[model samples]
Target: MKGSQLGEENGRRSYESLRRTAQALETRADIARAALRLFRTRGWAGTTVRDVAREAGVSVPTVYSTYGNKQGLARALADAADLTAGVPRQLAELEAAAADPPRQLAAMAGYDRRLFERAGDVLRLLREAGRIEPELAAVYDDGRVRADETRARVFSSWPDGTLRPGLDLRAATDVYAALCTVDVYTTLTAERGWSPGRVERWWSDALARELLDR
Candidate 1:
């Protein structure tokens, strides 16, 4: 029947469209991975779009068409880093413990550890690159602001009297954010050779003791 044929054609077109979308996403992921490797090894200032294209086995035009420029590629790499770091799952853990300040703080520490373990290189790369690149600097600044807001929201959600005496929500958020910074993590883990487990344990205990009333 004519109606049946029309439905079949539509189904075929839908399938083709889905396939193309998946392919495009896969290509972008490949480019991002290639860019990450180059950036990590050569530094952002040293890596070029041509190098990324060669590493990804794509054409230079493809790289330009896909990402626009180095900044766009950096953004893609940042996104991929978050995905590899399981940021969504970590956020969920924090959200699930919203009612329990101690548990929430512990989850925050866990999130910090996991993100550093998986994406510390990417973060460090962006931070170093941000010095010369205005766009990258803005991205880094935005990340800091978001991190502060996230901690503030978590602190604001706690029940009354959760914080230590004389510590307000804003103060608690500042303390938590300060302790959770990537610089602190790198200092202990990279400079002092402390294990991530040790850092997490210390942070968890420190956050609880500093922010929560006995």
Candidate 2:
């Protein structure tokens, strides 16, 4: 009977701890969303921790504790962008398409399209914020480097003789990364008024033509 009571007590403690943890995470998410909105409207340099706190309906200290500073918030926003872009699922699908290079390239284009369509504003925010904040700049650069590495892995997974005769993995990754940058996507979708579907189709056809053997 004593052991049963003790186990029940422990379970209650665990449940309480988990509830607190979940609440903290939800608060952080709310703060991050508020920060993104402020950053988008007011500009990164123009927004402040107090502003985010007010926007999130939390204390300024809460904002600081959750994100440390504006740069930290920017990092969180980058993470949010990744989540919104469906990167993990897309990567899994990309890996599964290794046997078919055309299909893989098309998948890559699809990921790019979804990324820009869903998270372009967040990415643009990061890029703009990175210009003035050295730490945020590092974060932005790190994201780009990681993306390049992912592209390299995808290219490396291609079957033998799948690439154009002269195009090696490194070269192929360079081209792919360059062509799929947020800047290019912005140019096509924002500046040139091309639809996401149009961009996806163009990228799919373009990448296949550039990298594959006839």
TM-score of each: 0.78, 0.77
For model 1, what is the error of residue 139's alpha carbon versus the real structure, in angstroms, after optimal superposition? 1.7
Q: Model 2 clash pairs?
A: none
Model 2 C-alpha lDDT per residue in residues 1-214, reported as the tens digit of each score: 6999999999999999999999997898788778877877897778888898999999989988888987778776776677667787787878787688888888878887888888788887677767877888887888888888887888887678889999988899888987887889889888999999999999999999999998
Worst 10 residues of 2 by lDDT: 75-84
- lDDT for each residue of candidate 1 in 1-214, tens digit (9 for 90 to 100): 6999999999999999999999897888889889888887898779899999999999999889999888878776776676676667878988788777788888889878887877888887778878988878776777677777888888877788889999997898888888887889999999999999999999999999999999
- Candidate 1 versus the native: TM-score? 0.78
lDDT of 1: 0.84
Predicted structure with the largest lDDT when compared to the true one: 1
Measured on C-alpha atoms, candidate 2 has an lDDT of 0.84
